[model samples]
Target: MKEELLATFSNHFEKPLIDEIMEEGRLMEVPAGETIMDIGQYIRSMPLLLSGAIKVLREDEEGDELLLYYLEQGETCSVTMACCMGQTKSEIRAIAETDSRLVMVPVQKMEEWMAKYKGWRNYVFESYQNRLNELLQTVDSIAFKNLDQRLVDYLKKKVEVTNDNQIRNTHQEIAYDLHTSRVVVSRLLKKLEKMKKLELHRNYIQIVNL
Candidate 1:
């Protein structure tokens, strides 16, 4: 983990900043399918993902979750920054999309770094910009696209993140992410299969194309 931290930090951060981070941060490994943060949870430590991916979800008033985006290697959580900066709570939930490793930095260090290091400030702003762009794209997709188109987009997104055309999510899981019913997801999957775009199985969908 020490070597991994050095490799990751060397890309953008200065040596002194990296050393302080290594000294102050704690390394944590999260298994696949684990929820790292939930709605309304207070932020204490900011996580810097070193490996694997995180699936970010926005929960509605009724507790239904809508997929927002994926945060992969070297991507920090923008929501974490918002909560840390404002002394607020998390509005979205973050789940490990794969077996993951993260370096958890105390909220104090996060704030100090932002003020003390130009690199840290730049990273924070870049993270916010990237997340905002992703959210805007998500809104556009939901507003202007049909359900089938959205489903295809979701599947393609998963493929892009995982680099695998085979998506190991059940229809119910897909529905939960897409904010639709399982029956609807199943019907659409069948339609997609018939169109020769994918093959549906018990738990996974294999993309034949796109």
Candidate 2:
């Protein structure tokens, strides 16, 4: 765990802060498609990604969910941190995008470390700014971009984060993340295939021109 922490966060955090994390943080491994946190759940700890990716999601009052952003190695979710600091229930959901490793830091230590460590403070502020920008981008995409374009962009982002040309998510899963319908996703995917942008299969979609 110490080695993983050092490898993932050594550059971003001071040695003393790293030591504190080592002493207080609990290392965890999560499998792909696992829901680690969900709406209305009280957040007891903040997760620091050690390896792999996590997808942060937001749900509507109707219970429809949309992808907010992806958290990669060495990054943490700002929304989760906010809930932890505020001692409130989680408004967003966190799921493992791949087989993931993370360090769960107690909520109490989060505020304490902010006051004691410059690196921690910077990290927290930067995370908030980054997440805010991503949220704005999501809003823009929904408001301005056509569904076809948004679907392409979403596929590209998945490819980027996973570093895989073939997307393994089913049409229904894609619909859930995009907050659309499975029928719509299937239609758009077929259109993309006809346009030579991608190839649809029984389960996964393969990138061709995308």
Candidate 3:
């Protein structure tokens, strides 16, 4: 299990430093639909996802949940920033989208390791930089891309499990992720269906090559 955590950080650091960090880490199990972190909750640890997926979301003024992104295996939780910055609260919620196992390192321990290990410090810096880049790209996409283009791009990027190229997500869920409205998504999906680009089952949409 510790080796798995080290593997997740291998892209950013030397294997030896990762091994040292993993030595201080412990595995945590989260059930599906569980909130790992809540708004206003201070995180004392950083989680490295070892298996399954989690959703990072925020609530709007209307109390609607808006998806910031999904973290899968090999990805570390964004809560690392809040913990490291000594933030008293977090606006984002990390919810387990599936039953997940995570390697958790206490914030204080991680800080200590950074002071002791130059490689580990570099890895954390690089990880934060990469995360910032991803956030900036997401913001740029939302600012410039239309709903149709965003939907198409999302579909292309998402994994579909059905053999028929079908995606099983509700309009409200899709709207939340795209920062749009369900009505708009419904209209766009209908248009695509009419053009024979896809077929809509009861709750799933199947995209087919023309």
Top candidate, metric TM-score: 2
Quantify how close model 2 is to the true structure by its C-alpha RMSD in Å. Answer: 0.9
Q: List TM-score per model, in order.
A: 0.96, 0.97, 0.81
Per-candidate local distance difference test: 0.90, 0.93, 0.73
Model 2 Cα displacement at 181 (Å)? Answer: 1.1
Better of 2 and 3 by TM-score: 2
Off by over 4 Å in 3: 10-20, 160-166, 207-210
Which candidate achieves the best lDDT against the true structure? 2
lDDT of 1 by residue, 1-210 (tens): 767877876776877898898899999899989999988899899899999989999989898889999998888999888898788989989999888999988999988998898888888899999999999999998999999999999999898877788899888899999999999999998999999999987767899986
Residues 68-166 of candidate 2 have per-residue lDDT tens digits of 999998999999999999999999999998899999999999999999999899999999999999999999999999999999999999998888899
**Clashing residue pairs, candidate 3?**
none
Clashes of each: 0, 0, 0
TM-score of 2: 0.97
Off by over 4 Å in 2: none
Worst 10 residues of 2 by lDDT: 3-12
- Return the number of clashes found in candidate 3: 0
